[model samples]
Target: MIRGEVIEAAMYEAMHQAAVHLPPDVEARLRMALAEESEPLAREHLRVSLENAALAAAGRGLVCGDTGFPLFFVRAGSRTAVDGGFGAIRTAAAAATARATRDSFLRPTMVDPLTRGNPGTNLGPGMPKVELQFAGDGDGLDIVAVPKGGGSEIFGTFYRMLYPADGEKGIKRFVIDCIRDGCYAGKICPPAIVGVGIGGSSDLCMKLAKEAALLRQLGEPHPRADVAHLEQELLLAARSLGLGPMGSRGVNAVMALHIELAMTHTAALPVAVNAQCLVGRRWCAAIDAGGRIACTGTLPPRETEAHA
Candidate 1:
């Protein structure tokens, strides 16, 4: 049986690296948006975003305090036996998070929604949420951690399609409709990432959308070609609406659109849209049997380097 301490160190480093390593694609999208954006307000937002990214990296601190509810995606190897039992993974992750909260950088965003008080730590008996999937036979682990905040989450919405033919049209409408709805209601922070979950049961659809955000690489292309095409179509339609950064008005609003799907009952096509704000804080760390970290990366780079 493999020990947990070695795994814990690697996981902690991974979470740190994930916070530091913003992937290239997401960075490119933001840089391009900054260049193309014209309106004073929208452009200003872009500038702040760039600076914030730089600051997070330089300080090695979290970009935003909304450290988000930690979501864990664990792919455990079949041949590897966990030290204590079936649940050693959770304990390892929580241990990693405690170190992440104290050492590197991440804010304590948890609170009592009713009392309006800070919880002081990111740990709950089952906090730092996690989802596990077991596959393969090697003694390795791949973990994806995402910190989802409240402002963007407040805009989350799901709609049950009344008819089958309405699926595509309904999706388009729901996205545009949700943004519009947010505009009218005046909350969803703009320049958001939209995750669309299609054709899954209600619960599955929601999970698919949130998981879609963790996929992270921009324009990575969905494995199912049709869904990939739909993502492009949605991007065009969404930008054309003039929602711009913070909905103040510009050429581009959404940085990217991510879509995921599941085969569903023919009678129903349930869809859910999960919105992620500009302050995206997610990282990934891979570990092996020796408890050594393999790789670490983040969704956006903390800074922009000028070309020579």
Candidate 2:
């Protein structure tokens, strides 16, 4: 059985990784855009971002200051046993959240919504969001930590429910408009990563949007051909908006676009949009049955995934 302490350690490391090291895929996307950005200011923004990433990775400091929200996605094997079962996952998450804040890897950003009371430890009810899943085959655990930025979540997330007749045109319109608005004055902090969710229930679409934005590998195309085509069209539209990093005039406003879909009610159509700032903070780690933990460059499998 894996001990709770080991889980906490793994979680803390994941948190630090999320903050200090932007994902390789995300960095690669920025570099790809950097190569094409001709506007001097826009190109400089990309250059600075690359330099910032290297500086943070080399132990100078974190990639971004606003540590936003602490989110943990965990997958467990059916054969794996923990010291405290499901409770251990949450407990370790909280412990890791507090530890990250204490160690200066995370900011104490969580608070009481109604009273606005600060815990100063970044631990409150549902502060460090945890999503859990189980698998039938593999023996151990995989966790992905995302230091989701507050700026993007606040300014770039949106939802709309339309009649089924709205169709793909409506979907495209909604997404393009959201991107135009979200990147206005560089509020969403381009070059942003955009995620779109369609055909799911309201909340499910929102969750899918959030996951698609933060979890997927940058520039990886969706497997479904139709959906992939939509992604490409919206991506080009987003870049054509004359918005660049910090509102510069260039094609560097959007780094990537991804969409996740689910079957929904026949009568209703739902869509959600989520975005991530240029920081694009995420990290993955795997813990073996013996409690040995190793960080992986590849992202963790989602709840929507199945074991092979």
Candidate 3:
């Protein structure tokens, strides 16, 4: 068996790269919008958005002030073992974040909520929320790192309907309602990419919705016809909101509205909407039995351009 330390070091490098590439996804999505957007204002907004990403990349800093509470989703193979445990992985991550913060001049957003004093480190109890999945593969692991900012997360919402029999329209309406409520405060950071999770328990629903944002290539729909139809229809309605990038009031405010649904108890119809800002910073890397792993950026590559 390969030593776990090798696996840990590789994962750390991947996570660090994930943070560095934060602006790539943002730039891609904005460029895609610019191509498809009809409004001059929306196009201009996308241009500025792209420019911000470029600046971040060139300057090597977080594109936004809120680096967000970090999250790690790990898939570990059966034969592989974690020698230092997850705490070690998290410590390494905080060190990477500290380095990124200093290099980027990002404000230290992690402070003790009680003493009103700053611990000065981004490492909170669960700040780097780690989710581990044990896959029955050889000795390796896969890690997905996401730095979720609050600006977009405030738009995340949950609801419980009378029952699941409320069906598709009900689910659609519930999602639209979430977007409406979230944006009512104009803080969701528009031209938003919305993720909806239906039928899971409230907490699970929220988790699924955020996970949905990381599903970059699995686009448009599930293989099921009815599910695909609902995805397309809801997407159209969401874009119709005219909330355009940053809720500036223009067309194509939404890039996509993604949904994941599951059956629940007879009396439950739980739903959640997880919204994302224009700069979606997410990356996924896979480690196999040989302690080898690689990360593609989190979220889909911009539909318009690919980074060299």
Query: How are the candidates ranked when ordered by lDDT, highest leading?
Result: 2, 1, 3
TM-score of each predicted structure versus truth:
0.86, 0.95, 0.83
Q: Which stretches of candidate 3 lie over 4 Å from their true place?
A: 1-12, 22-26, 84-107, 113-116, 136-138, 184-186, 218-220, 298-308
lDDT of each: 0.68, 0.88, 0.63
Best by lDDT: 2
Which is superior by lDDT, 1 or 3?
A: 1
Winner on TM-score (1 vs 2):
2
Cα RMSDs, all models:
6.2, 1.7, 5.2
| Model 3: colliding residue pairs | 139-289, 140-288, 282-298, 283-298
Runs in model 1 lying further than 4 Å from the true structure: 18-21, 112-118, 157-162, 182-188, 298-308
Measured by TM-score, the strongest candidate is 2
Summed over model 3, clashes come to 4
Lowest summed lDDT across 10 adjacent residues in model 2 is found at 299-308
In candidate 2, what are the lDDT values of residues 61-156, reduced to their tens digit?
889888999999888878888997779989999999999999999988888999999979988878799988676677898999988988899999
